[model samples]
Target: MHLSGSPTRPPRSRMPRALRTLGNPLEWTDIQKTILIFFPPIPFTLFYLYRVNGLLADPTVEPYISRPALATTHSFLVGILSAFSGLFVLWFVLRRREGTHDLFVRAVIHSWFVLMGLGAYLVGPFSTPVLIGYQAGGMAVFLLFDVRRAAQGGLVGLLVIVGTTILERAGLLLYGPVFSSVVFAGERPPDVWVYLNLAFTVVLTAAVLAGTGLAMALARARQEEINELLATDVLTGLANRRGLEDMLEREITRAQRFDAPLAVVMLDLDHFKRVNDTHGHRAGDAVLQAVGEVVASHLREVDAAGRYGGEELLLVLPEAELSGARAAAERVCAAIRALVVEHDEHALRVTASAGCAALVPGQPRSGEQLVRAADAALYRAKERGRDRVEVETDPAP
Candidate 1:
């Protein structure tokens, strides 16, 4: 024997703030951006390798104390390190965990910077001061902890490449002039510093621009979604009254200008109150939603269906004559009466009535007149018996 009493507690159902933020609609777009982050590094590494090889092929090119083999080795190691950093990006894609992906990407980018500093140790030291300035500027912009963190990341990345070139040259400089004589044997190879500056400038600029474009696209997408939510009915996913009115006015103007037929159909669920009282409000809601689906499915793509009010729907059919509109409205009524939705393991059926009015040529058929004519015909359908379609004819044309 069990005793029944009021429940002691309310249901504990709620999502935490952190989880909500993480599951924000924009999160997937950020994931899409991750694919682009790894692209610039590939070309950047290749360009750096090109600089290293350009020096190595020259007979005068020398590594720390005329060690040509060490210079080549340094170039190979830098390429390998850059390639490794790029490969780690794939892991981030596969993982697809936002927090972990951000953390890993940051670590890889920072580590790449550190390697650039190490690469400078292999090549000959700086000749012009501009090259050093390039490295410093890149390091400052990309690695700087500011609001534009990704821009900073790219900047740091470019600087790291320049740093790598500088590190190798600086290494040769500290070692001796023989190292310089070997690397710069006959003529300087267009100052590796110039190449470094160009690489950082071009790559970092592109990265920042690309990030900005992606951010703009995300914002645009959000605006479009908000507009749709405001204009669409949540239950039926059709245009709301405001949206319907706007569209109707536009279609009416176009039809009048072109002398094309425009039709309006106002539909209401018949005996809707009886259904709600007999079953439940849930069942009535189901009936309304199912009728909406049925009506939409029967209509052509050119026609617009909107939820006008409680248990009432409106259809705007352009380039359709009175006959065509009436036939379409009749079909919609039949479809709604045929619709049976399952509720609480029982099949429930409902009926709807429609009233259609068409704009005739040489008549001032405003949107208000068309809708009102349809509404009056809809009342006639209800009077003559529900679940039938009525058309307004003999209008003062």
Candidate 2:
């Protein structure tokens, strides 16, 4: 049965879907929805590589660019294309093999960032706008990969750009290495820098487009983080009541649309008032927080947990039936009985009673009705000597 994930950590599947800024392009982070090695679509990368190849290949493009620069750019493009082609061929041959795609996914994408930086530097002088390549490519890396990989890739990539500019300034390497006779004034290219300007402008345009896309992605991620923070409970680190109600409504809609099963579990602490009376409110708060953690940890990635109220929690399971919901509540009750929260150097113990309710397709029941049923079952658990599990199978409001 499907269940939503806990509060602190969202499901991996949901994380990727939430990043729908690029039309869900290139789930490079996860192997399941993985795209072509470095780029999302194969044609997009091929077109980008070939476009650069054409710029360097045409003598009219750079207007009498040097032989060394010509050969160097040609060789670089050839190598990049060949490497990508070989991988595609390998993937095709082993297409039917079970983990073949996994091997291809390890394709060193960030390394290409450094290579792009080096390549962009070669085509223009130190003052050329192509320098934006580092920033553009770095942002893309930061978004596509995780933090550690992003930092590592970005560090080396920036070093390549900065190191090359330093070398050119020191006369150790030729500025405008790709344009043989291209010379620059202190802060800008010289008057005879017409053709070089054209080439650099093209590179700048590409960088601008890439940077803009990455910036939008950054905004989307940040907004999502802010939204999650607002939804979370300050004390329990679980979804607050509002968040739970929102999730319940959404789950109910999904269940209705897809004819899927839906379940809710309402759990309340037994003798919670007694704990506060004996240990004080601060310690009682600690107990609630600890219990919330336990509940969040016990559920699957598809299970949703939230703080319903003081000493009470709710769980929303997407594809669970009445029996599954009942069993899940029982497991939760057992876990609570075994839990120990240490506050003020004292080992405080607590027990929980839980009630479950579920829905079938075309049940004509609302999420509120489902919650009320679970609440009724929870009251029954309390009446039947507490610290137990109960279920309400009837969908009637």
Candidate 3:
């Protein structure tokens, strides 16, 4: 047996703190990131293979000298791709061995750092559009990882790229290794090189952005769920005390601004302790939950209710005058008196005493003052007799 409005849903199971960080809120799974690690190198390797076959260059328009130069350039690009692929395996190996994500992540952080640096190197002399695109999109990986170590690794990678460009400009290294006057054995036409690099840059950036958008959407949804859990009352499905106070403050501001009448009604279940003592806490809870429904059903959309504490609820009614507020509280009292919560084989019932306090418009009154007035009147109702309503006479703004 259960009360009419008591929450009966099973409680949400909480994940362990460590497991929670793995994917539910923010972190991508190791498998997902591992696939990302594999994808980056494939395109670069294929592009270099195409270069080895002169598929990218127009031999009629570009300079061609030695076969050895083309082979050397192809080897260098392939080497970078191979190095990245070979090292990326550590992310998998260590992930299996340790099963501690942070341990594997820290182990592979430097590998990612080197990959980013080399990725920038392939298109960088600091001024290349492809390098700029890589930097913009590459930051998404760090965002997905979101460990402090990831940040440190990414920063080191960026610094190496920047330092490399500085050194290249100073003639310590080649400026635009692939973009310089004679690229390998044959120089591709300037416009062809530009178009190809631009295409690469666009594809690279778009992939990163698409992945980040999906991951961030998941994180944002989880955050909203957490916020709701923090603010809502699990038992009555109303705002809790803290959330109610915040609402009250905002309503007070609205009343002053729009010259609207506002009233606060504080309701306390009569003989609540006796219900717990005689019928057990479960029955008392049933009584409270049923009464919460009684108060909620009496309210309009503009009205708000919250559990102020045990066996007590506070309602905020907007655009309500003193008499209207008192009448509303009486209705709530009548409704609570009618409630019959069926617990086990017994039919438990409850009654509520309510106090109404209206806002004195154009007066500098705080939310606390309004609640105190209603609270004081609530005690008066109790003193007079249980199951009744009382209106506060003193505005005391």
> Candidate 2: where is the Cα deviation over 4 Å?
1-194
Candidates arranged by lDDT, highest first: 3, 2, 1
Query: Model 2: per-residue lDDT, tens digit, 1-397?
Result: 1121222344223233545544443342334322333443234346545655665556554544566776676677667667656655655555556653534443444556566667767765245555565555555555555667668766776687778888888999876566676354466654335654665557566756965775576566656766887788877788989999999999999999899998999999999999999989887888877887788878989999999988889999989998999888888888879888777777888899999998866666877888899999999999999999989856665
lDDT of 1 by residue, 52-167 (tens): 56556655433323455456555566766566665556655555555545555565455545454444444423433224533543443343233365565556656755655555
Which is the winner by lDDT between candidate 1 and candidate 2? 2
lDDT of 1: 0.65
Per residue, candidate 3 scores C-alpha lDDT tens digits across 32-121 of 464454456567567657855673354642442244444556776677667656656755565456354665555455555665576556
By TM-score, who's the top model here?
3
Kindly report which residue stretches of model 1 are placed more than 4 angstroms away from their true locations once superposed. 1-43, 58-230, 393-397
Q: How many backbone clashes does candidate 2 have?
A: 6
Please tell me which model should have the higher lDDT, number 1 or number 3: 3
TM-score, predicted candidate 1 vs. hidden true structure: 0.58
